[model samples]
Target: MKQATRLMALAALMIGASTAAGCGTSAPVDATGLRRVVGTDLIGARGATAADQRKIDRTAVGLCAGGVWSKDECERHGEGAR
Candidate 1:
């Protein structure tokens, strides 16, 4: 019936909205990300590849956005990875 179709469409719209919201969410700063930030900040990303460096940078941004690290601190440490 038209009522059933309307309900199904509403459900689909909600599901799609949730999926899009999730995709927009940034990756969390987890334990591994923290370790990488600390290691690279203290020692340096001397042996890290370009991709690894990029990951570290992204982790720093996540940490900053999550209030784990201050923007100045992240910048001072070169995005938490020297």
Candidate 2:
């Protein structure tokens, strides 16, 4: 039937589009996860200050907005502050 063929084509197009969209998309990351995304050095270097730490914390909060990861994601990655 023409209607059945058209529906099948539309379904195939939708599936192909969704798959193609993710072709260029990278996986999302948490705070600990971000170290893997951007690297541990950059995250630590820029996260040294109270203000900078706050920025990292905020970004982590946004990343794990749904509580997907624990609070440590927003905490300092190193031993202690200087």
Please name the candidate that would achieve the greatest TM-score relative to the true structure. Answer: 1
lDDT (tens digit, per residue) of candidate 2 on 6-57 = 2343345435644554565684332354333323222332533566555444
For each candidate in turn, the TM-score is 0.37, 0.31
User: Candidate 1 clashing pairs?
Assistant: none
lDDT of 2 at 66: 40
Q: Which parts of model 1 have CA positions greater than 4 angstroms off?
A: 1-47, 79-82
Kindly give the number of clashing pairs for every candidate: 0, 0
Candidate models: Cα lDDT each: 0.46, 0.41
Query: How high a TM-score does candidate 2 get?
Result: 0.31
Worst 10 residues of 1 by lDDT: 38-47
